[model samples]
Target: MKYNLFISLFVISICSVLAEVYFEEKFKDDSWEKNWVYSKHPGKEFGKFVRTAGKFFNNEEEDKGIQTSEDARFYAISRKFKPFSNEGKDLVIQFTVKHEQDIDCGGGYVKVFDCSLKEEDLHGETPYLLMFGPDICGPGRKIVHAIINYNGKNNLIKKEIACKDGVYSHAYTFVIKPDNTYEILIDGEKVEGGDIEADWDLLPPKTIKDPDAKKPEDWDDRATIPDPDDKKPEDWDQPEHIPDPEATKPDDWDDEMDGEWEPPQIDNPDYKGEWSPKQIDNPNYKGEWVHPEIPNPEYKADPALYKKPEICAIGFDLWQVKSGTIFDNILITDDLEYAKEQLKNLKDKQEGEKKAKQALDDAAKEKKSDEKDDDSEEDEDAEEDDVKPVEEPEHDEL
Candidate 1:
């Protein structure tokens, strides 16, 4: 059942064609860290990308001679971006990566969406489509993601990319044409890229998970919630090797020393959705999720659902031209009064806009009238002069 649901999502996200956030490069360069995060991911040390807030990424790595050897890679996530929902000749989204380590240090890529850099808070809660970045993650252990502020609610649409081979930062970009084609550009070269579109259905967010499974009302973290049914061990903390941070207690606290672990309780009873699978769901447990033909789990899926990527931006829209419709271009009127009211409101709204236009036209007419009045005055004066003709010069020289 679980497997089926997993496949269901994968098929919908992968097989079905939907909307996309097309992108293109604005600048190309080989030296990273100048603009990109050369050593650390955008965090408190690097201030923030969204909201213009947060501490910045760690400067210690660069302050010292510490570079990502292999385990500690860094990224300078973009603070500005244009989603696929904008107008542009073509998205020239470009990025560059450099390797300083003898062993390739993970990977580098851009994430186009809205989300906190925090990774743990992304469980069952409705996120404003925090687009997880698509790099560093490789085959079997990779991430692809997209996000949106759909219906004023944040929706996350993810596609996991498998981990790749030896690590080296490589410049990668995805071009989005106005006609709706996602051409993958690698190192300024056109490589292979596919189409993955989405709207509302394929990413139908699971609203309910564990409704009743909630942090207990009288829950005290220091003391274990007594199990009247006694299905737990008495000395669960006696195990020297446990990750439970709260197990440090007085020796007399659990006099039994029976080495028993208490059964954990659910905080949200309505929660049924996977906290995201420990592994990809395929073979069996079937409801809706499915596997993608080409998975990119950490890819930046959606950013529009966050804040408008930019105001008045005609950047990239959807991959397919059909993805867009003239929402306001054509108006359908049913009720006469209602239609009239709408028209009036539009006119009133346009009233502010038309005022400047009307002023310009009025000024033009005033100038023309002023010219005509001057000509009329000049004509009248000329007529008076003609009536009283001046005497001609006499031939006195003769």
Candidate 2:
């Protein structure tokens, strides 16, 4: 018994470590250039990716990430790795994206590709297993996409997940389990979660309403009906609009020059239009009819729909109208606790960055105010100089 217990514990420990981490990237230095590959094909123009400190939170030593250097250009960069399968384990992809330029229209997302991808000619049409992150363009479209490629078709999440709108670092996480459940997290907090079968159109439904089923001939779906006993009374037939009984024309009213004056009409209080029988409980009415369900013939069980058999590369293939988006602290793991620990470190760094940014903003505002004051004083001096001094009275030769 003691030996068996020891073996079980050892196996559990190994499993735990296996779930800890599969890949991680902090982009702390230029070492990323050695592992990452960029598009080599010639195009109209492509933005350069550089490793540098964040625009707002500059802790010269620590705050380092990869950012797009140019504006109005396309960016395609990817890193290749050993192929791994997420067959029986949970898949988690977490990364931090910072739009330091307050991006107007851009895509700050990452794509996971299989080994069959051609990294040299990467573009929008390249096949990818998953595309996860924020895509912001104008006011109407600010969404965090959780798209997956299933059976040669791309499926988008049915629900709209809004992305954070600001100039700060935000962590976006996508987690998928073997049970066909998925969750989306922003800054370590879950924002969306549900069954993948319901959220995406990966397959046809298991059961559908029977098209052959029809309503019975005597079926009554109405909830209310007119009362047959109610009838309109003779006095209820009053006119809706009647001539005013007390109104009279003014004495100064003219009939030839000004048009003929007439008494103002008023509404009749007792008038009721077109009376009908009151509605009463519909005793013969039945409840709503629900069509019988039938098994869908087109639906086939795909246990590996959420599996990526050979995920060997990850890339950022996007377009940016205005650039300067920093991406950092990317992690791919199955251990939630490990991901949370990394996120805590990022949160701490962001707090420090926030304080630094606030101080810089305050100083800028003060400088602008001082400049305005100086401009106002200069305008006043100019106005005084423009005024002509009173000319001394000129006498004949005095």
Tens-digit lDDT track for model 1 on 1-398? Answer: 99999998776555224323333222222232243332232232221221110111112122121122213322233332332333443433333332222122232333343433233222223133322223332235443223334445644344333322232223334444444344443333444444424322233333434333555444433322333344433333233233444445555556466455453343443334422223333333334322223333434444332223332111111111111000111111111122222223233323332454456568999999999999999999999888965798888775
| Candidate maximizing lDDT | 2
What is the Cα-based TM-score of model 1?
Answer: 0.28
Please report, in order, the local distance difference test score of every candidate based on alpha carbons. Answer: 0.33, 0.87
lDDT by residue for model 2 (66-179), tens: 999899999998988777888888899999998988899999999999999888888888889999999999988999999999988889999999999788889999998888
Residue 14, model 1: lDDT of: 59
Clashing pairs in 2: none
Candidate 2 structure, TM-score to reference: 0.83
The total number of steric clashes, by the backbone 3 Å criterion, in model 1 comes to 103
